[model samples]
Target: MTEVDLHMHTTASDGMNRPSENVRMALEAGLSAIAITDHDTVAGYVEAAQAGQTLGITVVPGVEISTVAEGQDIHILGYYIDVNDERLLERLRQLRSTRENRNAMLLERLRELGLDITIEEVIEQAGKSASGDETIGRPHIASVLVSKGYVASVHEAFDRYLGKGGAAYVNPPRVSPFEAVDWIHEAGGAAVVAHPGLYQADELVERIVRHGADGIEAFHSDHTPEDESRYAEMAARLQVLVTAGSDFHGERNGHELHAPIGSRRIGAHVLEQLKARAK
Candidate 1:
C-alpha cells in the first residue's frame, strides 16, 4: 500500500518527538509519505524533509493553522506549502508572539489563583521535556501542572482550566479561515480542514468548502468509522480531496509515537489533487 499520513506534529510545537525522530518512527512503521504539520510553524519541515529523504520517505511540507469559527477553535492543514514564504513566516511570527503573551497571562492567572506556578517554572518544565527546538505550548504548561499534582491529566487541565472559556482561557489572535487558506495558497500549498467533526457543525463544512478549502481530513484518529464515511461522502459531493492522518503528538498524548501511521489512508487520486493545487 502507498501509505500517506498528512497530519502530524513534532517538538517544533507540543509533540514529544523531534522532526528527525518522527521521520524515523514513520519509516519504522512502513509509511511511504508523511507531513510535519506543526502548529503555526514550518520551522521543522526542512529538517523533516531532509530526514525523510535520507530514509527514502516522502516528506510533504505542511502546517496546521489555528482558526476560529462560531467561537470554536478550528484547525486548517496546509500541504506542500513553501516553507520559505516570507509572508507566511511573518504572520506565523506574529502568531507566536500572541501565543507567548497569552501564555504569560495564563501563568499570571494561575499564580493569582494560588497555583504556585511561575513563568520560570513553566519555562523550565518546557525546556526539560522538549524534544528538539520545539516551542513550548500549553501542553507543556499542563504537563507541568500534572507533574506538580495540580491536574490528573492534560485533558483534565484543559477542561477545568486552560481550555476555551475555562478559568485561565485567553483567546489568542488568529487568522480567519479565508485568510488561512489564502496564506497557504500564497505559500504554494493546498489547504484542508483538519478534523471537521471535532467542533464544527455539519453546515460549517459546506461553508468552509465555499471559503476555498480544497480538501477535508476525512480519515483521522479522532473520527469514528461513521464520521469517516460522512466526511468522505461530503468530500465527494463537494468535489474536494479527502486526506487522512494520525494527528500524532508523541508521548505527550499518552499514545505511542506515530501510532497508526499511514492507517488513515488518502487515495492516490486525492494526493494528485492536492499536489496539483499546491502547484
Candidate 2:
C-alpha cells in the first residue's frame, strides 16, 4: 500500500468526497500524507489540512492547474503552495470565470444538439455530488446527462458530447506551460508536470523543464509501466525531483475509491524535496 498519495481531489473541485471525507479516506487507507490538489481551486485544502491535523495525517497544500500546450490541454500540479497568495487567487478567479462562461456555452451547444438538460439540472446534479461547493465542471453537466437518461454513463456523455472534440465542447482560455510554472513559483510552490504520458508530447517535457518545472510525476494512475520508466529516466537525466500519486477522485467520474488511494507508493522523501523547493 502507498504510504503517501501526493495527488487527490475533493468536493471543492470535481471529486465526490468532501475535504474532511477525503482526509478520513486517506487515513483509513493508512496513508501517512496526502495532498488535496483540486482542479483550479484551493478551497478544499484548509478543511483537509485541518482534518489531517486532528487525525494525524499530513495534508500538503496543493492545486492542479489546467494549461494548454501545442493546442492540447495538460495539467501542472503545485505542491506546498501558498494558498492565500493574492496573485494566485486572482488567476484562479479568472479561471473559474472562464469555466463558468464555457459551461454556459456548452449548455447552449448541448441544447442545440437536442439534449434535454439545463444549467439548473447540472447545478442540481453537482449539488448532489458535493456540498454545493464544487467548481461547476463539465463532469457535472455530464452527470446531469446521465441522470436524465440522455446518456448511459458519464463516460458515454463525454465520449459523445463533452470530450474535447465533441460537438458540445468549447475551448476555454488557458495559460501556457511557462505561465503555469511561473504562477506556481509565484505562489510559493513546486511545479510538477502531471501525467506527462497522457499528453503524448515527449518533446514537451524538455520544454517544460526549460520553463523551470521542479519535478515530474513519475508515477500516476494513468501512467503505463513504459511511461514510468521513461519519466524516471527523464527525471534522472534532468536531475529533477520525482513524485507519485493515485490521482484519487473518490467515486467521481468512474473512479473507484480505494484502488488508487493505496495503489502507487510515493516515498516521503520526494515530498521533502518538494517542500524544500516550496521554501
Candidate 3:
C-alpha cells in the first residue's frame, strides 16, 4: 500500500510505452511514485516527470546502467539523479551509440541466419512506440520478430538467439562497475545492484558492495520468495538498503506488467539515506 515502484522502463530503451503513457499507466495503477529506469538512457525522465506531475504522481529520475564483471552482464540502478547533469548525459549518449552499433551488428547476424528483419524495420517499430529522442533496444527488435511471426514470444526470441552467447549476441562495450558507481554517485544518486538473485552468487554481491553499491534490488519479478528472503538477509548483513520493483517492460513481456505498485516496497528510511547521499 506504499504506492511506489522504483523500477520500470519506457521507449527510451526497449520498453513498449512512451514516457507519458507509462506515467499514465502508473497513475491508473494507483502508484504514488514511479521511476523510469530506462537502460542506458534518461531521455524518458523529463517527459515522464512532467506527466507524473500532471497526474499528481511522484516521478523519480533514474537510469539502469549495464556493466560487466567476471564476464557477466550486471546492471546498476541509479535513483534520484539530476536529469540535466551534463556529464551524465554525455556518458549516456556514448552508451546509446554503442547500443545502436551493437544492434546493427545483431540485425546483420539475424539477416545472415535468414531472418528478414532489418535495422530500419526495428527502428520503424520503435518509432511507433517512442516519443521525442528515445533510443530503441533489443526488446524492440524482439517485438518486431514477434509481430512478424518469426518468434512466439520475446523470451523465446532472446533464448533462441539474442541473449548472451546466443547466435545474434553482440557484446557491447561496458564501463567498469567501479566507474559506474562513481558516475552514479557523482550524479547525486544511489547506485543499487539489480536482481542479485539472478546472478546466483553471493561473491558478486560482495564485489558490488566493495565497488560502492549502496543498495541491492532484493525483491524482483524474477526472484522467488526464498530468493527474496535470502537477499533481504544478505542486504541486512552487508549493511545495504534493500529495494524492489517489477523491472516492468510492458505488454511485450506477458504477465510482467502485473507486478503491482509497491509489490515489494523499500523502506522510506532507505530512500532518505539515498537522498542524503545524493545531496
Q: Which candidate is the best by TM-score?
A: 2
Candidate 2 error regions (>4 Å): 128-134, 253-259
Pitting candidate 2 against candidate 3, the one with the higher lDDT is 2
TM-score of each: 0.91, 0.93, 0.91
* Candidate 3 TM-score over all chains jointly: 0.91
Residues 50-124, model 1: lDDT tens digits = 999899988888999877777777888999888888988888877666667878889888877777777677777
Which window of ten consecutive residues has the lowest lDDT sum in model 1?
A: 126-135
lDDT of 2 by residue, 148-196 (tens): 7898877788889998778898877688888989999999999999989
Q: Listing every candidate in turn, what is its Cα RMSD in Å to the true structure after a full C-alpha superposition?
A: 2.6, 2.4, 2.4
- Over 4 Å off in model 1, which ranges? 128-134, 253-260
Candidate that scores best on lDDT: 2
Cα shift from native, residue 237, model 1 (Å): 1.0
Decreasing lDDT order of the candidates: 2, 1, 3
